[model samples]
Target: MDTWLKESRKRADSAHHVVPIRSGVLWSEALMRQSMPPSTADPDTSRPNRIPPDVPRNMHDSYCELLLPFASSPELLEQYINASGGIRTGMLMEHLDSLAGGIAYKHMLGPGVEVLSKDQGFYMVTASVDRLDMLAPLYPVRDMRLSGQVIHTGRSSMEVAVRMEALEKDGREQTIMLGRFFMVCRDAKTHKAAPVNPLKLSTPEDKQLFALGETHKDRRRLRTSVSLDRLPPTSLEAEELHSLFLHVHQKVFGGYLMRLAYELGFANAELFTGCHVLFVSLDCISFAKPVPIGSILRLSSHILHTTSSEQFPGLIHVGVQANVVDVATGKEQTTNDFRFTWCTDHNIPLTRKVVPKTYKGPCGERLGFSEELLQRTLTSKTY
Candidate 1:
């Protein structure tokens, strides 16, 4: 793992050779060179420069166009369903993260995060991708081409327009997806935000995609506010958190733990439909001991109190625990816990009356606590 990370970092630091054409137009010959492996021919040997034959142009001939068929594949759908509880939102988040890393990086010169404030729900059903990892009847690999260029940049955000299409398919080529993604990049270590370097769009096609991104930004801003309170709660174990840690780098991504908290609390809500994730102001999560993977994680949540002045109710607290068993020594370990708070939507009044003192689940066990530490470690910040 350490070696892999080192090699990845080295590749990220290498300078890219940018080829200059007309003013405001730059292309990376280094990217093309890297796409091909080193040739066996001697450097001094003369080689013939042959003219390539003309190929039929397809309507979907774009970088992001390559990604569409993969996104639409039945095999890819099956893999998504199997991995994360068949929840489309989770699967879409994972896919957007993958695309943002690939296409978004093509426009940004450095490593960055594309914080997806809005949901990409069912959008990929028609989007494009170059390679689709259908971890199906086992995973199968398909290759396609991607073309992405930067459209706009702001104080702390940048937008990239991407197009993907099939390059060498024995079958028909189709327009699977076309869209723009807005990204907010930050310094990896400091977490302070940064701006994307100015991009020079050379093609009319590139200009068109950039314009689309500008128009889409307004709709995206509104959708970002749409709450996902209708989804049913899902459970997780300590082992799952450990497994998640192995893959995710961002602390915000690790907030899947908090997602579990929301799930637990909303399930127990007297008015389930009225519950929403109003805000998470501060969080200070710590792992006292590493929970083994595959442990049954149980979570329970409830409204501790309510507030009239606030946008939502008072606070919703969620408790999480892991059910673990030692394989070598054969002993059971229970009780790893965390808490979360949520506010109700004041604009939408609750129709159901609140239930009185009827909370259920394991209670009164200070399984892991220290007298010296009176306050909880995890905290949240409200919006």
Candidate 2:
């Protein structure tokens, strides 16, 4: 793990890179306030225990930890493969998204609190994936553990951290993937943003995680400014790219976009790492503009950085950007920015390193900004 950290840092600092900043934009307070309409003026006195403002500060109220022990069965992998024989990252992402939603639901509850359907109900949806660090590759027969917890909260948003761990046959465990998911609460009926119960910070670690969540929010504001507009890259480094174009006739889901980006990223990985690459992590993923029906969605993906190791060969980091294009005006609106990390399947030994070229032009600019964002969120030497 220490060696992997050193190698990643070395690649990041290598001269093969050139990378951006824009003035940060603040979230609309008024919009947030309006999204959360006050509940009934005259509450039902019969159910006084429901949705109270004051809740106890207990671990049960603010934290959710799940442990699932299993292996990525051959059948599971077979069900999620791309044309290149690599597993589709979308399958894993969808699972994690569901898990994050469960954590948020648990954290938002008061002790023994349950709401009847007639009463106000809160639902959660993934707003963004702040950070994902893939520490190692996953394959069949590898024992695994998946866990999630709510680290912080805003008026209507919850910051949750989830991890995937690989347990060795010798009774040792190592984290293979770590991620931060931002979830937003919404009214079940109105389907609009709604207030959620605040998180109760107790342990020192909880406080620390909460502070980290705050920092991510700050960085996201800066990222949003630069992601407002995007142009096709002119750099020769972008020549070996992978792309996907979709025409939406109905409101598109964020997961669909994530899946497309994952496909393109994995495709880019294959250009150098071969057909056996496995997903690592996704960093600084922000869904900038929601795509309605009748929009043209384009995704362009390229390798950003890479390194090789005797123990784990052909590690590649990929960056992806999505745009919504106007077919008539030929204008494009940048929709999302994502950084994905993957490695060659352990079963396959890499005789050579997959080193990506130094990025230039628009691609370089985006890569530089992504690298900066990655440094801020990554604190551990290894996943």
Candidate 3:
């Protein structure tokens, strides 16, 4: 294992000059400037080879940019309420890290191998995979090679670079996302610290990707802290509103605010279960404050926008706020705020539901209290 590690490191260091071009660009244009293919120099080569034609580049750059705050789709918010699952931010982090690990193993490890062990770390508030998965299916564990560079190495942790891409129908590939993670390995059962295998980075391209991943780590941190202070309002019945209050925290566990957001849609129409949550992607989540275990919380939500796709018939955005008042002392405090995305598919189409044209607070007509109350709704994506 030690000898293989040393040799692999040497090879990786030597390969540093071969940089990978960004996906979704004109590959022929870029490769044309480089040396001939290795196959051309082999004496046994018989068939003629040709460079593939260039492809048009029409891509959404949003996938490439990292670290911007995200908002949940309306469908996701509603699902939160309907399913009563409580998805947390930490779970989301786990999912992201797991996906990253899968990508690294699939791309780096040779055949006939399984991941024997894996470890991760975090630096500058961003996490990364440090130790490679040991047990691989196709390749000997000691013969495996990784291509990314270390951007930051700490006393007990390090951050390495990574990126994702998808091939388009037009024979073009697009750069999806780039970021870094921290990693540290330990004994699986005892949970004691372990040493990292010596790794040698070879290529400049690998170093560049690793560096980009580190930079994106900061951007992702920033995006996760957005505020939602600009959502509109909808009306609800007293009974339905009370039910919503009971499950504000419960629905958040599902990771999409849209589950709860769709419930608000039903309340707005004075109808029960009129809307359904279909698809949801977390845009942002923030636990600005916590809700007490037992409290009668006032909950409210509003629609952001709606569109239709072939899979889902309706799409919408809903924002929610939770507030509680102490009955004994008459003291009240805002507890939680969130935003969500919602969508639904039902046999019946939704009729235009009438929403209250004007909002009035608990007290009648003395001041523009209703508008103030509505404005208090948490609409920011930061969490």
CA lDDT of every candidate: 0.34, 0.58, 0.33
Query: Per-residue lDDT for 212-232 in model 1, tens only?
Result: 556556534432222222242
Instruction: List model 3 lDDT by residue over 202-272, tens digit each.
Output: 44544443354455455444333221122322345434332332322112222222234335543443232
> Using lDDT as the measure, what is the rank order of every candidate, best first?
2, 1, 3
On TM-score, the candidate that comes out on top is 2
- Put down candidate 2 lDDT per residue, 1-383, tens digits, no spaces: 22222222232222211111112223353235335544542233122343543443333343333333435365554566566554455766765665676666656554333322223355566778877766655543555566566666778787777766777778886766777788877765565567766756555555556677788787665655454345444555243221111221134767677777887888788776656677756765765556875578888887666665554456677789999899989999887777777667754655555354653423324445354544433432322
Better of 1 and 2 by TM-score: 2
Q: How many Å off is the CA of 250 in candidate 2?
A: 8.1
- Name the candidate that leads on lDDT: 2
List the candidate numbers ranked by TM-score, top first. 2, 1, 3
Cα error of candidate 2 at position 334, Å: 3.7
TM-score per candidate, chains pooled: 0.31, 0.61, 0.30
Report model 3's TM-score to 2 decimal places. Answer: 0.30
Q: Among all windows of ten consecutive residues in candidate 2, which has the lowest summed lDDT?
A: 14-23
Candidate 1 Cα deviation (angstroms), residue 235: 37
